[model samples]
Target: MKAVLAIVLCAFSAVGCGTRTSSEMKNIYKEDQDGVRRRDAKAEEMRYALSFGGCTYSLIAQNYAITAAHCSEESGALGTSGAAMAAGQKEAKDVQLDSLIESGLGSDYKIYKIKWTSKKYMKAQHIWTKFALKKSAVKLSIKPAKGDAVSTVGFPYDGEGQAIVSTGFLKKVSNYIVDPYSEIEGSGLYFNAGITGGNSGGPLFRASDETLLGLTVSGDTPSYYSPNRPESSWSADENDVWNIATPIWVVHEKSQAFRSIVQGGTP
Candidate 1:
């Protein structure tokens, strides 16, 4: 009687295992198709993304693009301004910016006119055409509320030259005063989207409408902070940090050249 009971239990366990395996097998093909669709959609959205100076930029017009002010040649932050390469391009093209239109110090945003000289004219046109065809140019939105879903498109250092997209929600909006003596005030959009060195100057888009919300500027690192009160204890955990972005409103408020571009006029 004990052997009979043991045999029945084994049979039931095998039936349950078989059922789960069959159900999972049926979903595998569907899951693969869904993944493919997502990848294709992301590729289309990032068609206008460009890589340059070990950072990312988005082509908003045929001859204009936006990036972080720190990424400009004048900043000396990245040391060298390298060639720019559009997505799907086999070779990078030597591109030059006419001038830097920055939103003051510490604001961390800039718009520049691409210099399309004779050598780069044809290729630049070709790249812009592809970008326009995909309607990848994003519109700017100054207002971003906390908890708003957002996405970032850029070439991370670890991405091996391929564009990587990260998604997160807006965590906070605050003023980042880099220098108290200089009295320079800037606005920052704090989010949790993972970003790295090469992602600097990349666009941070609102997930719902794809509007340009900000530009990726810095990521959190382990550091120390002190509060005014002596009893408070605080330490910067390497893991407990938020990625920051320069809100687009900073440029809108500070740069006249940026306004012209946004108003459908040449910068």
Candidate 2:
């Protein structure tokens, strides 16, 4: 059999090393190329599985939660549509999908019921990029910081072939996109790791006591074009590097709107 394996290389300007000046380990999460678990610290969190006609996103949040609007658009399901689809149900029906996600489905998944959707943010986006998780069953709100550690969970190439649970370390203050920085609050979470196409919208989490920081936004340097053609303008290889991701923090307001459904107490 041919030997096929996943490789994780770390070294980039995104993490903003040396200048940031921190004694902490800058690895997003330490994992083997095969994605085997040396530590399952973020197992308790929720994985927001998203699907799109072109791509599937985990809709990873900053607080160990996963969700994807693009995925819902392709599935014709929306938490606010009063008709969300279920894992077993093929038809898109008006029902809360969060409970199905919160129950901890036999080590394969964790169930989380949608009490109330984040209407504010969910409405502002192009639709595919705006969605969130909630359950009218909590209180209080806490803001995450720049250097907070977070974890990630997602289904890439069937969820097993690729590594999961990336650990993220804080990098710096920079604009991922020129002028568009204001669109994302002019701030971003940078980390060193091995993430790519299938990993988009995957969960980005924190494990100090189990909290979310953001989603798996982007990788160090990836091909803007097809991977097969490295020299192409689209290829984010040695010549061109492009890192992109929808910041989970953008939905903070929506999260606050459904404060009643905010799960968990402070650590």
Candidate 3:
């Protein structure tokens, strides 16, 4: 009976030989309008997985993008900012910023300052550094409710250059105590969504409405499976893992500084 059970488990398992191919696995992850699934076509477009440093970021406005400050090199945000001004490049090389702010989350959580005048100016300014300027941005959710379904998009290390998505519940909404060394302000949200090293700065979204909830900063590592180990021996407590995010309202509060960029008032 034990052998039979093992065979049954192996047949149902996603990994291993003779299991579903990558294409088949993709089909199983199809996103539906009902929002039960986390992946969304629109959400994917808003997210830009940064390659310079391991981090994910999203466009909040035509010209503005936000990310975890730690993702920027400890030396400084300009550590990677050295691309010569060029025209017609699909991506801006060595993209620098007009302004970069900590956004009250210490010097590590940075908000890239962009003033978009025209496509020509955006290129001249090297606005496409990490990702080309997306046409639109994600709709920010000022206040997210506890227990709300949530999803996150990131460029996890396993995904190589591809963006990966994970869904879970909003476990809590509380103040994020900032480290004295970091020096930050404001409350943040806590969720059970999966996050990895490269997921830092990724956007979390309310699954039902697809509105932006917050940006992923950190999470507890979950367990993994080994081929030599039996299925019954696999030990992982999904319930225990939780992730932290900086709320969108905090970003909104600081919008006064970049209002003209998003409002089309000035570049």
Candidate 4:
């Protein structure tokens, strides 16, 4: 497959990650390329599955959770007509999608802040939430070199509250465009793994050990440009494969800045 998998940033929204897949489509019961279905009993993997705002996230820090910036209303899904807030769902003023997200993550979770958000594209928010978990959060570290094996752990298709896992090799470290308009964000690490909707903000970890590599943020599939209509750019076909992530180093670099902002200091 030589298709360009465009960044499926947030899966829930209309323009998000696209359709949800069944276990039959991807066979969650069986192992994926160099990856296996995480047993429900895996404590570490289970600790990483976080449900909130119609998406899944990784518990990156004890009090901090990382998710795609589009997970919030900034993605145009929080409009008055947006389905983000269900009927009868109510919160205090200014607590729209953020409030819904906080509630979805559980009463223990709250909106800590956001980072790497684009005012133009409004897609790479890197939504951060604060909460406590029974286990320690994954530590953010340097990005893995190309060819390094990595695995994704999160609630695929919501996985009935279970965390699903997939493995692939680190393809490269680069930037991924969200759309043809030319908007972009943080450095993205591409992996060979295939992630369906509901896997956004999941952890991309080193397979040999559980060390964190990055966070799975988006997947993309590109449409072939037709020659009859010559306005299209004839880029190499990406085969509609490959997944992308915002490297953990971005978060690691901003952790102190985020903390400072929360503490009433300049970030």
* Candidate 2 lDDT over residue span 23-99, tens digit each: 11112123222221212222222223332221233322222233432222222333222112112222332223442
Better of 1 and 3 by lDDT: 1
Model 1 lDDT, residue 216, Cα:
81
What TM-score against the true fold does each predicted structure earn? 0.60, 0.40, 0.55, 0.53
- Write model 1 residue lDDT over 61-146, tens digit each, in one string: 65677776555344222211122233344244445566665445667666767654334323333222111111123332223323
lDDT winner among the candidates? 1
lDDT of each: 0.50, 0.31, 0.45, 0.43
Q: Put down candidate 4 lDDT per residue, 1-267, tens digits, no spaces.
A: 111123333444534333533433343223432342333324434444444435555433232344554443332222110011122211211111322223111101122332211232222212223321111233222233236666776655535434556665666666655332334334666676655556666677765656666667676322212325321222111323456766655554445543453345543
Instruction: Provide the lowest-lDDT 10-residue window in model 1.
Output: 32-41
Off by over 4 Å in 3: 1-52, 73-98, 105-108, 114-146, 180-186, 223-239, 258-267
**Cα displacement (Å) at residue 29, model 3:** 13
lDDT of 4: 0.43
- When sorted by lDDT, best at the front, the candidate numbers are 1, 3, 4, 2
Residue pairs in candidate 1 whose N, alpha carbon or C atoms collide under 3 angstroms: none
User: Which candidate leads in TM-score?
Assistant: 1
